[model samples]
Target: MNQTPQAAIYSPVAQIDALMPDIAAPVDAADFPQTILRFRNDRAAASVGLDSLSDEAWIAHFGRFEPLPGTLPRPLALRYHGHQFRHYNPDIGDGRGFLFAQMRDSDGRLMDLGTKGSGQTPYSRFGDGRLTLKGGVREILATEMLEALGVNTSKTLSIIETGEALERNDEPSPTRGAAMVRLSHSHIRIGSFQRAAFLEDRALLEKLTDYALTHLYGEVPGDNPPAQLLGRVVERTADLAASYMVAGFVHGVLNSDNINVTGESFDYGPWRFTPLWDANFTAAYFDHQGLYAFGRQAEAIHWDVAQLAVSLRALVEAAPLIEQLERFPALYAQAMARRFCWRLGVVPGDGADAMIAAAVRGMAMSGTGIDRFFHDWRGGVAREGHDYDDAAWDAFRGAIAGFAGVEDARRHDYWTDAAPCSMHIEEVEAIWSAIDTDDDWAPLHAKVAAIRRMGAAHSECIAAA
Candidate 1:
């Protein structure tokens, strides 16, 4: 396991092994019959200095589960408990995926590369540890679109088609099998703290909190580690919720396990980008109560944050955690206004919140897709033929008076088209149809290209902030 790191690009830091060793169990990866690389994010790989691998080498390391040089000698399936649909379940853990390696990016960000549908672990219980190829495809599409839309999201690093067939109740049985690797700022979830608190392990809780402070956040105001941690988590989660609202995304499942401490969105399942702004629009099929609907996403995340705070109370007083939790509404409001203005390519002003409210009301009154509404009114100016309720438009115009356009993105080639790139569920199905019927991947490739182009068009908005 002490394989010397051949060169700089492969030498990863074994921080988890040296720091907190009790929360995960090492396991071997399943030996797939074949490894066919279908998707490789060169841009994401480049950031972590992994862009130089040939396809064969990439498959060997990513698909065949060869240990990265100097890092995790073996994959570790993490252990934790989460409240699913507000019901606490103590039995579930990482049954299919595991943390494979850790490395530092160009910006010195501590990035973790984790697997999905890798193999069975101690927590596999009675389930087969495999992922359907279509599921992998959807995740790649979801992560790419979210990142382009300015959400802090996990990057789908590699998706390899494994030579096997998986049976599933949701999709057509005997579906093609696949395994995926994703890169993110951190894999520590709110559920991790919940597990420590559940066990009444005070020492481990402190260790986890301190580890998070030094790794994720650089510097902070307070000395009490637990209070500072909760406050930071609240701030990040608020921003995460706001990003979802601005982009009209329904996460479908806002479980504690899915909420990363870094507030980076990951674990795409039953997700959807709402075409129209409906308060009751839902993405998951089983969500009969609409708990995590489009409009309730912020509330759901706030509830998740509260669970995290409750866990933190084992180490710190409830009052400080409550104080930090109180910041969510205000912080969420600010992030919504800020990100909305960022999308509209307008400079933020004192009236940014009111302006965003007016814009939202107009979208609701126009009965058009939120994407179209934003596109027609990009730069805070209504186009000639795009008129909503006159009163709402008046309110919008009044609220947007002093806010100037940040930059002229119309010069970009992407804006030359009449429409912005969209990821409506229908288009997602069409892209999958070609693959399922004819093994054609052109549509998926083209969509990724178009989405990246849109991101490039709005690069100034992303960078200026």
Candidate 2:
């Protein structure tokens, strides 16, 4: 990694070249007469060697949609088909967004600079390609909270208020507008392969598999490249599902296109963190069928993985693909147990699964705030003021007795805080309401600062361990 004196370590690279029709349907940025710098993620920029750029330069590249030097001059509106709520939708691609640029991070992993609500593209079917300022704020909160909770998720790199008022049926009309950029491991989704399979493009599918294996799954070794890629993705998807469960997150939409190939969670739309443990708690208002409910998230992701397997059949043997598919249940169970224990601040041991089950049932039955419970019971010890009179509490107490200490010493300071960091809907609305009413950004900035503090604490724990 070469680092210039002022610039962060960034190596401009175009790893997604094999996918033909590479140039995104060119669309100009919204002609916003005013561009206000709302947020900039310097930490993320440093990771990709863009921290050296001035705020004016940052706004120029991200806000004004100027091309990053030594990167793709034209953004690529990646083409893919997806299954929306188990119904195959062929008219889906980068409807309101595009892959803006590609570069290598300090660790040499390929990273993507993708946009949301920049402007309309060829795929923007009869819709204005603009993002609400409130929506951008919600995404910033979502990604921050998820990262603090240890989920592999996309980071909101930059947010620029495009200075436009937009009308919407869901929220108050004439809401403020903005554009956002997300930094993530990869933008390739399961739908990427689904599109290839749908077209019966055997050669394109093969090329995509090769590109994915080289850039995203290089460590996956096997004679059959498709099978190897499938296996690795299955493992990652399982881990991702468990992470969402532990984080108490409801992604609202688990469609194939929203499911990333690297297993990292991205695209925050109508997402919510659970207020309590209810299996059927749905995030999206239109999800009346509860297809992607909180309780059904693991199941939903497993179904998406099966769709990916169906797509992979065009490039590999069905037997091997099915063999990889069969491993999902066990993989999910193992990941759940491991991640659940990590959140509870205990080492996994005998009866770990039982403990996890008891905790979940207890929280659901008692309607205990999930985040509060974990914070109160850090190190397997109930805090001094909290009561534990119920049978479930008794079971939980006994379960932790056989385990070791918390994951890291750094977490102790966080536990000392009066309340655990939480992002329930009302709280999120409060943050946004302040901004909307008085143009006061204090609440929003404070919430972000607090969340970053929590993230720094977790990062320290991982680093020390």
List the RMSD of every prediction in angstroms.
Answer: 4.0, 2.9
The stretch of ten residues in a row with the least summed lDDT in candidate 1 is: 1-10
Q: Which stretches of candidate 1 lie above 4 Å from their native place?
A: 1-11, 220-222, 388-392
C-alpha lDDT of candidate 2 relative to the true structure: 0.83
- In the range 1-465, model 2's lDDT, one tens digit per residue, is 001113347798877776756323545666676789989888778889988889899888888888887887777788888999999998888877888889887778889999998888888898898899999999999988998888889989998998889999999989999999999999999998898899898888887788788887766545898888888889999999998998899999999999998999999999999989888999999999999999999999989989999998987779999999899989988888777766666666778788888888778767788898887877677878887778767677777788776557335477788788999999999999998998888998899888877666554443211
lDDT scores in order: 0.84, 0.83
How many steric overlaps does candidate 1 have?
Answer: 0
- In model 2, the runs with Cα more than 4 Å from the true position are 1-8, 22-27, 407-411, 462-465
Using lDDT, give the best candidate's number.
1
Local error of candidate 1 at residue 274 (angstroms): 0.2
Score every model by TM-score: 0.95, 0.95
Candidate 1 lDDT, 1-465, residue by residue in tens: 001112235437767764557678889999999899999998888878888999989999899989878788989998888999999987878898999999987767788999998988888898788888898999989988888778889999999999899989888878898999998988889998899999998887887787788787865435788889888899999999999988889999999999999899999989999998888999999999999999999999999999999998988789988999999999999898888887787887798887877777777876667878777777767666656537757788888877887767354676556777889899989998999899999999999988887776766453235
